[model samples]
Target: MENVSTRRSGQALLVWGLLVVAANLRASLTGVGPLLDQVQADLGLVPAVAGLLNTLPLLTFAALSPLVPRLAARWGAERLLGGALMVLTLGIALRWVPVAAGLFTGTVLIGAGIAVGNVLLPSLIKRDFPTRVGMLTSAYATVMGGVAAVASGVAVPISEVAPGGWYTALGCWVLFALVAVLLWLPQMRAPRRAVQAVRGHRLPWGSGLAWAVTAFMGLQSLGFYVVVTWLPRFLQDNGTSAATAGWLLFLFQAVAVLTSLAVPGVMRRAGDQRVLAAICSAVMFLGYLGLLVAPGAAPLWSVVLGLGGGACLVLALAFIGLRAQDANVAGALSAMAQSIGYLLAAAGPVVFGLLHTVSAGWRVPIVVMCAAAAGQTIVALAAGGGTVRPATGEVPDRVPAPR
Candidate 1:
């Protein structure tokens, strides 16, 4: 009885720790964009340099994600996560130094830590809660979205009264990171999983389905980041107040959070994700179209995007587990999807802005976003079946047509 009770306690702790992980995933990153002006003023940075501050983390994600699974294979997922949390804590504090070098360096560390967490969590869920992948994936996604939205909403307000303005607001995330580290201590001490199954020596790079999954992951991320980076400015440029535009962006994220909670229930009875994925893609396309066609209804379009984008995020994360045969494959697939996904997403904003600059209007850029969403649907249909595949180095031709 005592053993069973202890195990239950441990499982609960793990879930709590993962929720904390979800919280940490975006809070630190999201808070910065809102505080960018303050950071710019304090650091005496050029516009290009200030923009680099935001782009640095995604670049770190792109560079570091592919290496994390192998590290987790040797170090054990629990210990790796604990170490990542520690790094995140250090990065958060170092970012508070109010120095330009400190800011950039700390941001890199934060990304390195989060890159590990982002790849591991889905695989861990596959290992521990095999029967409940959809539920738990949505749970973490909801937590991530909610915390990110709140972080972005509160950053400016927090900086206004905090001792060091943006520095303090940025550093505030360390408190959560520390708590995650403390809670994760027990997981590291627990017996590690067999190392052979998840050696991650061979990612699913050769599989066609794997590529489809990666494309879905990348395209969804591309749309989301493009919207996140430009939505406020687009609103403001169209004659909205800065404060109102910020609130609209917050509403956009809030809707995503609320919509994420409903995804698991949809996944429960559905045999495959084909319809759901298609719906999400089409909805995002419409949202972008609405933005391009009628900027005055931006508020409504924001909510529509939140609904579609949030669901897309949950599906993208869940696809790692859903498409993989086991925890080992989940680990590898997660690595492949995110390494390429983030790299693609990191380039999205730059390309999105370039479109705007060359055309001298938002039309060309938004049309491109609409095109990306259309592309997302093609990959979604390709990857949406419930078929699970192994980590073999070849593509399967027997995949069922999407219903």
Candidate 2:
């Protein structure tokens, strides 16, 4: 009985730790948009250079994601995660150095740290909570979205009172990362077994279903980042104040938090997720169309788009676990999907900004977003049809061997 109770207590701690990590992952990035204008003015950056601030992280995500699995294989996931948290802390702190070099350098470190967490967390969920993936995924996703919303909403206010202004607001995320690191420290002491490599078994890089899942992940991420990067500016352009635009962006993320919390369980039970995918796509399409046609109804469109974006994100993450055969494969597939997906997504904000610069309007960029939504719908249908392959074996639940 004591052993069982202790195990349960440990599990609970792990769950909370995971949630805290998830919360920090996006807060650092999403907080930037709300303070973007101020940062631009402070740094004397044009729109394209400002857009690169958002794009650079995605590029880092693309570049670093593939390497994380190997790092996990070597260092153990728990230790790697703890190390990543430390890096994230350093990165966020670097932004406060009050130089353009400091800002971009810190952003690069932040992206690299987040890239490891992004690829590893789902795999960790699969490995540690095999029977409760949907519930736990939903929980962490909810926390991630909710924290991101709060970060976006309060960024301007925080900057106003913070001594270093936008730099302080951006750098404050290190506190959250530091807390996560402390919470996660207990995990490093727990035993973990190394995942054995399967002989003659290569990852399904060419599988059609794998490609579908990758595409779905990419398109959904592309749409979400584009909004996170530009939604505040969009609202501000349509007669909303900067503070109001920040709250509206918060509304967008808050709605997503609700949807993300609810969607995973529904997806788990449904015979096929295609219907859900179709519904998500429709909501996104209408939301974008509404944004283009009726800037006056910004609040309504933000909710609609948030619902769609949130649902799509949950579905994409769930697919990463549900489609894999085991935690090891899940990690590999996650690396592949995110590597490709984020590379595809990295172009979104930069391209959106460049188009806005050349065309002198938001319409063309939005239309491109709508087209990405269409692509997402098509891929989600394919990905939702069924699982691609069963995991060969479960990764043993023990502390990974020392490097």
Candidate 3:
């Protein structure tokens, strides 16, 4: 009974600790876009360079993702996560240096830290809570999306009162990393054990299902990053108030939280998730269509976009664990999907802008995205069905398997 009690206590800690870690994943990055104007003025950066603050991280995510499984194999996930939080903290603080070089350096560090969290997290879930993937994925995703929206919403407000202006707003995220580091410290103390799993899993490059998953992940990320990058400016360009634009973005994220929560339950009950995938993609297409065809209904469109984008994000993340037979396979699959996904995502905003410039209006880009979202429906159908091909040398799937 005492051992059982101790086990329950540790499980509870892991649950809430994962939630806390998820909370930090996107808040820091999301807050920066809303405050980009201030940074641009303060640092004398051109618009081209100003955009790097966001894109640089995605680039880093792309570069660093493939190495996380190997790193986790050597250092163990808990210790690696702890080290990442420290890196995140240091990176967030480095932004206080107030130079363009400082911003680039800090952003790169932040991306590197987040990249590890992004890849290893699903592996941790697969290892620790094999029986509860859907539930836990939904919970953490809800937390991540909800906190990210809040960060974006509060960013302008925080800058208004933070005496250091945008610097304080940007630097405020450091507190979250600090807290996560403290919360995760207990887990890292177990290093007397051997290094974690995640070896013997190849990249799954030959698996068509794996490729489908990677494409789904990338397409969804591209849509999301592009929207996050430009939706505010798009709304403002059409004469909406700044506060309203921010709130609309918040509403988009808030709606996503609901879908993110609901999709996991559906995933568990359904034979396959193709229907959910199709419906979500359709909703996002309509949202993008509504924005282009009738900018006046931005709030309604934001809700639609959020409803779809949120679920797609969760599916993309959850599939990493759900599809894999074990933590080792999950880690490798995640590394592949996200490395390519963020590479695709990293190009979205730049391409959106180029289309806008070449066609001399946002309409061309919206049209392109509408087509892309339509393509997503097809990819979703493929990725959402059929058996997940396990990475090479993976053990058969297990239930309630502890790492």
Q: Order the candidates by lDDT, highest first — what do you get?
A: 1, 3, 2
TM-score ranking, high to low: 1, 3, 2
lDDT of 3 at 29: 94
What ranges in model 1 sit over 4 Å off? 195-197, 386-388, 393-403
Q: Encode model 2's per-residue lDDT on 72-158: one tens digit a residue.
A: 877788888889989999999999888899999999999988998998888888777876777787888889888888887788889
lDDT of 1 at 376: 91
Q: What does candidate 1 score on TM?
A: 0.95
State the TM-score for model 3.
Answer: 0.95
Q: Write the per-residue lDDT of candidate 1 for residues 1-403, one digit (tens) a residue.
A: 9999998998899899899888899899888888898799878999888988678888888888888778986888888888998999999999889899889889999999999898899888887777788889999999999999999999999999989888999998889889888888888888886532245646888788889889999999888888888999999998999999999999999999999999989988788888899899999999999999999999999999998999999999988888887777777888889989999999999999998989998999999889999999888887887444665563332222222
Of candidate 1, the 10-residue stretch with the lowest lDDT total is 394-403
Kindly list the per-residue Cα lDDT of model 3 for residues 1-403, writing each as its tens digit.
Answer: 9999999999899888888999989988999998898899988889889989989999999999998878877777888888998898899999867777777888999999899889878878887888787778889989998999899888888899978888888888998889998898898896533425455446788878878889989999999999988898899988999888888888888999988988877887877778888888888899899989998888788888998899999988877877776777788889999999999999999999899889988899999899989988888888876545555555644544321
* lDDT for predicted candidate 1 compared with the true structure: 0.86
lDDT of 2: 0.82
Span of 10 residues, lowest total lDDT, candidate 2: 394-403
